[model samples]
Target: MALDNWFQNWHPTFFQQPLHHDPIHNSTGKRLKNPTNLLPIYFSLNLLGSEHKNLKGPSKVDAHFPTEWKSKELPFHNFKDDLPGEEYDYSLPLRLSSQPNEHYSSPHVDSSTFEKSIYTKKHHNTDETYEDHHKLKALEITGPFKTWYRWKTLDFAYPSLLERSKAIAKGDFVVENNLPLGIEVYKDRIFMSMPKWKPGVPVTLAQLPRVPKEESPPLMPYPNWDWHSEKSCDLITSVFRMKTDICGRLWVLDSGKISITTEEAKQHCPPKLLIFDLETDELLDKYIFDNSFVKEDSLYSNIIVDLRQGDCHDAYAYMADVWRFGIVVFRLADHHAWRITDHLFYPDPLAASYQLHHLKFEWMDGIFGMALSPEGDFHEDRILYFHPMSSFREFYVKTSYLRSDGDHDDGDAFKIMGESRGPQGHASSSVMNQDGILFYNLVSRDSIGCWDSRKPYKRENLGVVARSRQTLVFPNDIRLDQDKKQSMWIITNRLPYYLIEGLDISRINFRVMSAYTDEAIKGTICDPNVHNKSTYLEPPIDEDCY
Candidate 1:
C-alpha cells in the first residue's frame, strides 16, 4: 500500500493538489500502502483528531477516568492538532477539518448542495428550462442545515448526543454527522431521520417544503440539549437504522431496532431504514418490510446489516435483541419481517447458565455484545449476546440456542464470559472484519476478547489484544481501529450515582463518558469493586448458557 503505488489507482479528485510524502512516515521501516486504497479504513480511523476539524479538549493527557472524550454532554472544543506529546496540527492540512470554532455552527454543506446541483443540471439542460431552474432557485430559501452544533463547555463527546437531543429539542429539520465518541469521520451524514419531540414523547416533524419560505422563520434554531420533559427522550431521539456501502453505492447492510412499552399492550420498536444520498440532503427510499408472516402481535428488536454483493450472492442481513436472544435473517433487499428466509435462533434451554426462563421474553441483561463474521460457516450468522442476569431473567454470554445449524441443539456451542460480574450500559458491542471478531469483556475491567472467526469459528483466544486494570465502568461502544494498536476505541458512558447519600442515584440518568483506545491498555485502572446486587443490570441466569 505504498503512497506512490496507491496514487496509481486513485481518482484524479484525490490528487487535486501536489502530492508529497508525509514526514511522519518518511523513514518508517514497516511497509505501508498508499492512502487511496485505504480510503474506507482510514475514514473510520481519523475520527477524533486530524480527521475531524473541530476537536475540543485540553492538550494535556489527563488520567483516563472521565477524560474530555467521556462527557455525555454537548460537543464543543478548542482547536488542537497532533497528540499532546506530539507537535503537529493536522487541522490546517485537512480541508474538511473544522476549526474548534466552526463546530459551533453547522458543518460544511457543499457535499449536499453539490449533489442537488448535479441533479438540477441533469433534469434541465436547456437554459430556458424554467420549471427546473425555478426548483433549484427556490431551495436557496432554506440552506442545507437548519441548525449546527458547536460545543463550548464540555469535551468532544457531548456533541454527538446534542445532535440527537438538539434535534428533539428543536422542531425544525436538521442534517447531521455527529456520532459516538472517538469516531473521526465527519461525512456520515443523514438528513432528518429522528422523531422530533417538543417536551417529551415521540412525534414526527413532517414540516414540508424543504425550501425556505418568505414569511415563515426557518425551523433550524439552536436548542438546548437538556430535555425539559423527561419521558424516554433518549429512545425517541435514538437513531432507528443505519446503512453504509462501498463507494457510497454498494450496499452493506441496513439495521436498527426500537423499544416500546405501554400498559397492557406492548410492542417491539424498530429503527426505520433511512437511505441517504449524502451528496444531496434528499432521503432515498426506506427499507420498510412486510410483517405479516411473524406472529400477529409480534414486535421488532435489535438488528445487524451485512450488505455484501458479490458473484457468490452470499450477502446477508441479521436482526437480534439488544442485550439477549432472538436472531432472524433475510436477503438485503427483502423487506418482509415475518419471512425470515432460512434462519431463526433463540437461547437454548439446555445450555450451562442459560437454563430456560419460561417467560414471555428471553433474557434482559445480556444484550451488549452482538456481532457476526463470514469467516466460518458454523458461526456464519451465529449471534452473540451478554446481559446482567436480573432477579427475574436468565444470564448467558454466548448462548448456543441462538445458533441454528441444522437440528444440532447440543448446548455446547456457547462460551461463558463471566461468573457473577454484572455488565451494563451501552457497553454491549461486537464487530467483525476479515481477521476476527471482538468485544469488551463485560465482567473484566478494560478487557476485550477476540475470537478468530477466520478458518476456525470457535471462541478461542487470539489472546487479549488490549487490557488494563483501570476500572472503566463499561467499554460500552467498541470500534475497530487498524490505525492505533489493534485499532480499537471503547466508549464508556459514566453515570454518577449518590450511593453514599439519601438520594437514590439508581434512577436511570444516561450520564456521558467514554474511553479512547490505543495499542497498550496494561496501565489502565479498573472499577474498585463489584456492582450492588440491586442494580437493574443483573440478568436472571439458568443452567443453559453460563
Candidate 2:
C-alpha cells in the first residue's frame, strides 16, 4: 500500500484543476470557503480574445491580465452574457492565496526562465494608456439598472512615477481559466499548437486525470477546440485533446494502471507506462521501461525536451516503420499511423493495432512540416489519437504505431501539426509541390497552402501560393473517400475543428511537399521589424505580420 513514485516523489495531489476553488468570507462572515470555479491560469477564459481575433495594434497590453482574476460576473462583457445561471457564484477565486516559499516547494525553477528572457524589452511600448486592471475601484452603481460600475480610480492610471497620495489603489488581482478544449481527430495523436500567453509566462503545467468522456461536455461545455483526441490518452487532462488509432482506438500512457509488482527497478518504483484497448475500452497492456524519468528541479527528469515546434522539420507515415528522419529513415514496424510532420515519423504511435496488412499511412511528412502524403497506405490506417503539450510548445499528435510485423514489435513519441504566418504564435512546415514548389502553412491546414515542386526546399522566398486556412475534407479520416473538393476554409481558431474520425490535414490538401520529403517556405531571418524605427501608431493592416 505504499505510494508509487508518482504519488510519493512528485508530492502533487491536485492535477488538472488545481486552482478551481477558493477560501473566501461567505455569508456567515466566518471565513468560509467558496467555489469560484474560476481558473488561475489566464485572467479570463480568452473567449473574448479568440472571438475578437484579428491583427491589431502593437504590443499594447490588450487585456492581458497579469493578476490572476475571474468573476461569477462574466469578464469584461455585461452580466446578461454570463452563461446560464452564472452557475454557482461564478466569482470563486481559484488562484493560490499566497506564494509558497522556495523551501516548501520543488527546488527546480524553470531554467528556461533565466536563460530565455520571457519577453523582449522592445515589446514595451509606452504610448498607449495601459491600465493595470489588477487595481479595483469602488462601485458607483451608475446605470438605471444600478448594476454598472467602473474600476476605482487611482492617481496612477499609467506609470506616473507620482510620489504623492493617489485616489484609488491596486486591487487584489486574480487569474481566470483558459477554456477547456477537446478536439476532433482521425489521426493518431492530437495537437496543441504553440500557446503563447501573456508575454512572459508560457505554461504552468497541471496534470489532468481522466474523467469519463460523457462528462467532458458538461465539465468543459464551452470554448471551441480546433483539434481531436486519440481516445487512448483521454482521461489524463481536461485541457488536452487526444488522437485515436485507424480502427477507432485511442492511445494513451498512464502511470496509475497496474502495479509494478516486480521489485527490479525499486528506485524507478511505482511502475509506469500503461496503454488501453479501444475495442474493449479496457487496459490492454502495460509497459515498464526501466528508463523511467526521475524528479529533478521540480520537473520529471525524463523530460523529453520538445524540439520546440520551431525545430521540428516535418513528418510522414512511411514504409516499414520508416518515416524519413531528416536525411535518413527513423523506421517504424507494425507502426502506429504517423503524421509526425506529415513528412517524418518519430517512431511513436498514438495507438497500435496488431495488424500487419496494407499499411494505412495517409499522413505523409515533407521537408519542413507535416504533410499528408503516403509512402504506402495501410488498410488499417484509420487515423486516431492526440496529445497537446501546452508548456513545451509542441503538439504531440498520436496515431497507430503497433501491428504484427511478421513477428516483430515497435514503439516512441512524446508526440505530434499546422499552418499560418502571423505572430499568432503559430508554427509551420513546408510541402513540395507536384511541380517542385515548396510551401508552408498550418500543419494539416488543408486548403491554405501550396508550392511549386520545381523549386521545392527553398527555405526562403517560398511563394504565397494560397492563403485560406485548411483544405476541406468531407467526413474525417478513414471515411475520406468522400469528396468535398478543396475550398477556401477561413483562417480562425474558434471554429469547431475536430471530432472522432475528424478531418485531418493529411487526408486533405497538399500542393508540393510529399511523404519523406520537405518543402521550404519564403521567409526572412533578417527580423524585418528589428530594422524599422517607427513611432507607436495604430497597426496598419498591410503591415499586419498577423
Candidate 3:
C-alpha cells in the first residue's frame, strides 16, 4: 500500500503479532507490517474495556538516586515553637555584603561519546538508577525508546533563515528560539510552534510530514519560514499554541510580543490570530487583535476551538492570556472579540513553586491549560475545563455562559466544578477527545494523567496512563489526533533543565512521543468502549469552509 494510504488505516494490532523472537535477547523485536510504526494506519477498535480490577502501580522511585547536586537535606525543626497559630516565614534572605562566587564551569557534552559522557557511567551494579525501574515498564508497552527526532541546535531549511538563527545565537548565549512547543497533528503532518522568546530567528510557525521523507534531520521551519516581509502576507511574529479544525485550517495565536529577555517587554507586531489552509498552504484570513481589553502585558499562550454550532464560521475561538490572567473569546463569523476576567484565573500563592528533575523554580502562570467537553456530551451543553499552572484546582463553566448573544463581561457566570486536587503541580497544555477523556501533562510527577468528566475526579478516577522521568520530563503539549483510530501525540523539551541547569547543545534536547489513545485509557475511567453507547458522538457538519 502507498505510505499515505497505510498511515490513514494503521492500527495497534499490527504490532501485537510480532514477526520473530530472539531467544538471546528474549524480546518481541519488531513488527511484521513496518519496522518503524510511523504510518497512520489507524483502527477503530470496539473494545469492551477490561473489567475494573485494581491495576498494579508503578514501582517506588529509587531512594538512592541523587535528589540534589549541592544542597544537603537540612535537619527538620518545628517552626510552630515561635509562631503558634500564625504563618511562619519560610523565605530565606541572602546576605549581599559577601562577595559572590563568579567561577563557573561548562556542563555540556556530546551525546555520541557514551563511555566518557555524563549521561551514563559503566557501573557493574544495574539496580542503582531510575532507568532500570523504567525499562521493564517500557518493554511491556511497544517500540524502542529511541527518539523520533532530535537537534543539536534548532535550524531552518532555508539558508537565509538559517543564517539569521546563527546570528541570534551569537548575540545571546542563552536562547529559547530552538525549543519547539505546542504541537498539533493533522493527518500526515505535524505543525510546530517556535515562539520569539529571543529575536533574530525567523518563522514562529512551521510544519513537517508526520514521517519525514528524508532521514532524521535537525528541525527546520517549513514552507521557507522566513522573517516577516513587508508584504505582511506570510508573516507570523510569535506563536505559542495552535489548533486544527475539521475544515483543514490551522488556527494560530501570534502573541506579538518579542522582548530581548523574559523581563523586557515590547510588541514587535500587532497580536493577531491567523488561519491557514493546511492542504493548499495558503493564508485564508488574519484577525488582528487591537481590542482595548488586550493589555500590553498580556501573554496569549493557548487557544481552544469550539465547533458546537456545526459550522466553521459560527465557531468560536477561546484564548488564554496567562500573564495578564484573562480569557479572550473570538467569534469567527462576525470577526468580533471580547475578554472575560475572574479571580479564578489568578494563581494560588501556595502552589507556585515546583521541582522538575533537579531544578526548582517558582512561576506565576495563570489559566494556562483549557479543555472543552465534547459537544452534546452534557445534555447538549459543553463545559470548558481550565486550571492555573500555579494551582492544583480544576474548574469548569458552561459554553452557554461564555457564548451568550452579547455577554462577554459576566465574571459571575464562571463556576467551579470540582474540589481542589492539591499541589499535583503544573500542567502545560491539555485536550479532551471525543470519548470525554481529558488528558493533561503532569510536570511534577513527570507523567501524563487523565480524568473522566462522567465520574468524580478522585484518585481512583484519575489514573496515570504513561510515566517516564526521562522521556516525559517537561511535556509541553498533549494533543489527541481526530483520526478514526485515535492516537495521543506529546512533545517534551526539558524546558526547566535547559533554562536552569543549561543543556549541552550537542545533545538531543527535544522529543516527540506518541501512544495509542484508546489503549491508553483502557483501565481508566475514560474508557468509553465499556459503555453500551459512546459517551459523546460528534454532530454532523452541514457546512464546510471550502
Candidate 4:
C-alpha cells in the first residue's frame, strides 16, 4: 500500500500485534484507551517519511522498527496543538506502564530519548529545524522540603526535646519562611543557602547528601550546628549565593541581614566574605567589608571566584551589590576589598516591571547577574560579563578595569554585548563553563538560555537549553561544577510568589536541578558544531532618535 494511505489507515493496534511489543500498557494489562497515546507512532512515521521520501510500502517502515522497544513514554503530547485541528485534552486519564522496559534500541532513536524526547520538523519558511530539544527534563534533586525545616539535631537554643517541641508549637520554626536560595555541589554533598528573608530560619548555610536517602531530605547545618548561632557575629548570618573554587574551598557571600522580608529587618553584622576549607570544614578566611566599600542599602547577592592559572593563593572574588549598583572585588592576596561602580550597573526603568507565573511586581534591582569567561589567551584580560536583574541587556568589562584603582568610567570601559533580550529576557544568576559558553536563567520566561562567546551576541545566536514552566519557574541561580564532567546546577524557588503571595507549602515550591553542560546544549543552537546562520532583524530606529 502507498505510505501516505497506510498512515491514514493506521490503527493503534499496529504495535499490539503478536510480532511488535506494546510499551505502554494500562494497570489492567490492557492497551491505553486514549488515542493520544498513538501520537508517538505518528511522529515516528513522519520522521521515517522525511528520511526516506520514496517509501512506498508500510512493510518497509515496519522492517525499520527495532526488535527491542523501550518502554519510554514519549512527550509528543506536549506539541498536540502543532497538529492542525487536534486539541489534546490533558484532562483525559491516560495511564502508562509503571515498569519501563530496560532493553530498547533503534537506529532512529537518539540518546536524548533516554533523558527527554525531542521531535524535530523542518520549518517551511526557513532552513531551521524546529525542535523541542530546548525543553529539558530537569531531575529534582531535592525540596519543597518545606513541610518542616527540621534541623538534624537540636542546638543550644533548644537543647532538649521539650524545648524544641515548645519552639515548634510556638510558631518559631515557620517552615514556609525557610526557602532555599543557593545550591553548590561538592564531593558527596549539595550545599544549600537559606537566607533569613523572614523569621524562623534556623540556619543560613546548610548541606545535604547529593544522593538523597528520602524523597525529601532535611537541611543539615554545614560544618556543624554551632556556626548558625543567632548571637555569633563571626558565623554566617544570611547567604544569597556562593561559589566553590578549583581549590578545596567554598566562598560564601554572607549578607549579614535577617528578617529582610519583614518590617523588623536588621543588619545583624557587617557584610562579610567567608572562605571555608571544604575538606577540613575549617574557616580559611573571613574578611568583613569596610564601611567605605558598602552602602547603607547595599545588598551583596552573588559571588564568583577567579583564580589566575589555577593558583589558589592568587585568587580574587567578584561580588554583586545588587541594591547599591556596584561590584565589590575581594583580593585574597592582600585581604583588601574595593567597590567599583558604573552607570551601566544600575537597573533600567523600562525593564523594572516583571510578570512571572501571573504574579506582577516591580523590582529596581541592579547588577545581579555576573559571569566570567574562561581564563586563556582569547583576550588580553579575562572578561567579566554581568547584567542587572531588572534589565534585559548584558554588559561586560575587562577584569583589568574592575581590579584597577582608577575611576570605573574610562570613556567606554563597559560595553553592551549585543541587542536587548527583548522584553521577557529578565535574567538572574549566570555562570560560564570552561568552553566559554555562558548559561543563565531567564527568570521572566521560565527558561535557561545559552550563548557561545565566540558567536555574535544576537537573538539567533542565543539558544534555550532548558525550558519548563513547571520546574524552571524563576530559576534563580546557575552554577557549573568544578568536576571533570562540568555539570550545570540550578535552584528554582518561586521567589516572586514567595515575596508577593505566600508559597503553597503543600505543593513543590522549590527544586534543585542539574544537567551535564556538554549534554544540555547538545543539538541546540548553542552547540558550536551546529552551523545555523542568524536571521534576526534589528528593530527599526524610532523617529525621535533621528
Winner by lDDT: 4
TM-score, every prediction: 0.39, 0.25, 0.67, 0.71
Clashes of each: 73, 122, 7, 0
- Error of model 1, residue 446, in angstroms: 5.2
lDDT on C-alpha atoms for all candidate structures: 0.26, 0.19, 0.54, 0.60
Which segments of candidate 1 are over 4 A away from where they belong?
Answer: 1-243, 247-272, 279-281, 292-301, 309-315, 322-324, 334-368, 374-427, 441-447, 452-471, 481-486, 494-546
For candidate 4, write residues 1-546 as lDDT tens digits.
Answer: 112322232222111212132111111112112121111111000000000011111121112112432323322211111223323221111211112113322132221222111112212423221112222222231211111112222222234458557767876666667777787776556777888888888778877655433334455577666888668878888888778876779988898888876778778888999999887789999899998876766778788887765678988888887776678888998997788776667666567788775677777777888887665432435677888787777766777877776665463466655456766678888877777678888887776777755545555556666655666677777776654455677777887877777787767677766766777766555555553323122222221100
Cα distance off (Å), candidate 2, residue 421: 8.7
lDDT tens string, model 1, 180-257? 222111122212112111112222211112222221221221011332122442322333222233323211112222
Give the per-residue lDDT of model 3 (tens digit) for 241-320. 88888777888888886642345547666778988877666788878886675674677888878775446677788888
**In candidate 4, where is summed lDDT lowest over 10 consecutive residues?**
43-52
Worst 10 residues of 1 by lDDT: 45-54
Off by over 4 Å in 2: 1-182, 187-241, 253-280, 283-373, 376-455, 459-546
All predictions: root-mean-square deviation over Cα? 20.5, 27.5, 20.3, 20.7
Question: For this target, which candidate reaches the highest TM-score against the unseen true structure?
Answer: 4
Winner on TM-score (1 vs 3): 3
Score candidate 2 by lDDT.
0.19
lDDT for residue 63 in candidate 2, whole number 0-100: 21
| Model 4 TM-score, 2 decimals | 0.71
How high is the lDDT of residue 34 in model 2?
21
